[model samples]
Target: MQLQKKSKKISAIAQNKNLSIQFSLDGFSFCITDLTTNDVNLFSEYIFEKTIASPELLLEKIMYIFANDKDLQQDFKSVSAIHQNNLATIVPNDFFDRNNLVPYLKYSVKTLATDFITYDNLSSINANTVYIPYVNINNYLFQNFGEFEYMHHASVLIDKLITKIKNSSIKTGFFVNVAPNLMDIIIIENDKLSMYNSFSYSCKEDFIYYILFTAEQLQMNPEEFQLTFLGKIESDSDLYKITYNYIRNINFIESTTCFFNEDDDFSNHSNYILLS
Candidate 1:
């Protein structure tokens, strides 16, 4: 990555910290790691009171974060950004064609001529993630960091989960990453990705409905298939309670208390994309 320093006065360490930021419709979170120590020196998130309406407004929110968050306004040896949105689709590697990006996402998500479509080749899952990223946000990062790397959040979440279960004793199960209004469901069978899909819900009914509906389509019995929960959910939450009511073998997957050198308390399941 090329370094783009915003200030000459900033120390060389400004060029040392590797920065990673994940953006969502609801908010964005970032982490900076030291080059020499490999320690996460800073980690924080800015969640909007409600989900923003447009990419333009989302860019404004990111601008506010960069303006206010001093640690983020520095140079970096490397910068990686993750775009989290529902506008993505997974195409099996065998059927994936670079020129078919627009066609791949058009049916699942609304697109426009101005939309810049890109993809991540998820070799692990033998799939390619085709989706649209926030061009304005990428431009801002280019202006600040000169060159950086990015991918759809699904690429991170799905690829990681697929690689993970393939190594474990687990064969067939349901892994769900539950966010405030969204969830990622990965159904694995015989150590292969049977299905992976994300859904948005306003109520518990909507949430379980999508999960059970997907399982029924796959002929997965809820009473038997194991369900492991991750992301911003607690056992006490209504989301957890409702899921447990329907699924018999349900539990939260255990993760370390912290990944940073400092005790910046974060759950294992919370930032599985960024922290892990």
Candidate 2:
């Protein structure tokens, strides 16, 4: 399958030895870092819409990266993938049964594929439950990359946001993570997760509509509840302008810099916190 290239710029640090990959419906992104020096050696991202119909495209891209970079091929120490597909559901811990996870998913999603899986977030013990959904391309990764850890992107973000909230005095707020054509909305109250879900939007209006609607449904006041933005968002972008116009208390969540060397370019990358 022929894949259209969206943006293909590699960072100066692209020669790093360690690698981390993130897969989304719009595309796949990988970061090369030197764990020894804690510096991000390189970062590359690609966009391919035909990935769903031809999952092999994913393998092709991975191979291309390995083939071109000899440093990445020989010095690679670890590889981890974050599945960004939206077909996931969160269930509470008390009533969660592994055996019934698939059935529970089927009732909510119309999936034709049989390879459903789950990820448990140990950090959120109070809201214990399994996150269920299928990551189609993981099979290809296992066959090619050997053993590696796979996680629902939402699970990672939720865990990170919850940890941040727990350390802060803020008792109630909403966390919004914007991905390519997708968004993850998480609600926290009193240091516990009240709601966690994903939504797809084509425009800024749709995006704001979902936020306002969710806040209204939960009886949250837009002026009172703090809303933190993360992922692919810019302060000058229309999405930010619209959100600011409607929501009184909103700000960009600071990106965690431990995973990569601090650089002006690195700070511009979206979702670095969750992707790392």
Candidate 3:
């Protein structure tokens, strides 16, 4: 279902704005930015009390937000949606084929003949991010707003972290992006992506198990490597508290360094992808 609203008549000057949305079955959040001044016009997240069981419901929730959130019902120079799900994996440039998409994801994730497959190029690492975009969600957004760019949230998360790794003195470390129901663990070594994976957790025990397990697989020492936290997390949150107990030399990505933060209420390290 689509939201009912009159077409917003944006003046020619309105093109200097952009909308960024990141969503999954767990939650939905969006932000609007004034490109001319590099300022954020608005940012809001619609929390889901429990995980939505189906795509139809998720789409309905998004449509409801678009109908009520006055900030979302505006014109923009561009709109980009980030699909946050574990149905994504990375492929080295040498093995990537434009003619075939299913083979890349077949082993990593179960795919059907009907699943719509797409990829995002990771030029920074000479690879491509392959995954399933929300075809239904894309159709809905396209139906209302016309053509807009979209990609897996992992694509944005990995690429942005790569830039940070290259510029930092530290090379090898773990970067964990925590959201409502899932977390992505990205391992970097010598300024290159060593590993990238995402996990779903329902409790603190499950959360720390994934991180500790990943570290064990890589033989990474808890006391040596510095870990950086990002996305919807705080120093006192259960996730951070548990992580700090297991990992040493932990820190957050400063908000001042974040390009998309203009609101005092927004956490410096939260929503790293949407604000990017």
Candidate 4:
């Protein structure tokens, strides 16, 4: 019998205590920062682009490079992978057996963030059976893989949103904006979550209808909650205009908790740019 040989190159950095890493396998770029850190370190950053035959190999190889760090060695809790199709997997340990993983996972999508899968939105997605909505829409209308992370980018954003939701302790009334292509929203409240709706439209009117439809499902009104928008810009396109245009007259205010970063320069498109 022959074994499959891994084919890949890797790079890594030991993030400062104040900085964590945000890597997009699709974009081939990684950004590190800690929101609570000092202003100087927060502003200074690094980024790079490269490809790997397998994204997991890139992570294992990079972790090997950072093996000297005691914190990464000890506190390493979980490993999760998100896929371009917006599906994700959460692994308990990096070295766990592979054959045991598939049956346990009914759906398979690659991951963006390496560890830290225990957070909110991801945890919900990880815990439940995610049903992908496949309608007869023409996929070719959009750019072919313009910047879709095979797994990790959206996972990272979901993780941050989950963290924000968990920490804020705000319940019963908040809106979350999401990208049209990714997974559907899972409303988190009182540490429990349930699927809200699924969509594939980039137009605000489409989203408004969807939201209204969701509200109808939940037996609520569109004017009752605050609105939060995600993925406002895709690389160079200003999508927020369309997003805001739909909700402009509503009394609901926008929430910054979903807008994790203020830096507009990050490569919002081209998921292939994420560094492995």
The TM-score values for the models, in the order shown, are 0.89, 0.81, 0.89, 0.42
Please provide, for model 3 over 1-276, each residue's C-alpha lDDT reduced to its tens digit, 9 standing for 90 to 100: 333221222233345888888888978887777788766666777667778897788888888887787777777888889999989999999999967989988887989899989999999888999999888899988987898999899899888888877887876868889887889999988878899998888999999999899999999988887888888788888888998899988998755335443545567578788765
Candidate 4 Cα deviation (angstroms), residue 158 = 4.7
Error of 2 at 148 (Å): 1.0
Query: Tens digits of per-residue lDDT for model 4 on 119-210?
Result: 12245335322212111111210132122222344454445455556767567433443443332444555544444433556455665566
Q: Candidate 2 regions off by >4 Å?
A: 1-17, 36-39, 48-72, 126-136, 258-269, 274-276
Higher TM-score: candidate 2 or 4? 2
lDDT of 4 at 49: 36
Ten consecutive residues with minimal summed lDDT in candidate 3? 1-10
What global local distance difference test value does model 1 have? Answer: 0.80
Off by over 4 Å in 3: 1-15, 256-265
> lDDT scores for all predictions?
0.80, 0.68, 0.81, 0.36
Q: Write the per-residue lDDT of candidate 1 for residues 111-191, one digit (tens) a residue.
A: 999889999998887888898999999999999889999999889988777777777888786888887788888887876
Model 1 misplaced regions, further than 4 Å: 1-15, 260-265
Error of 2 at 200 (Å): 1.4
Where model 4 places Cα greater than 4 Å from the true spot, the runs are 1-28, 33-84, 88-159, 173-184, 196-198, 202-205, 233-276
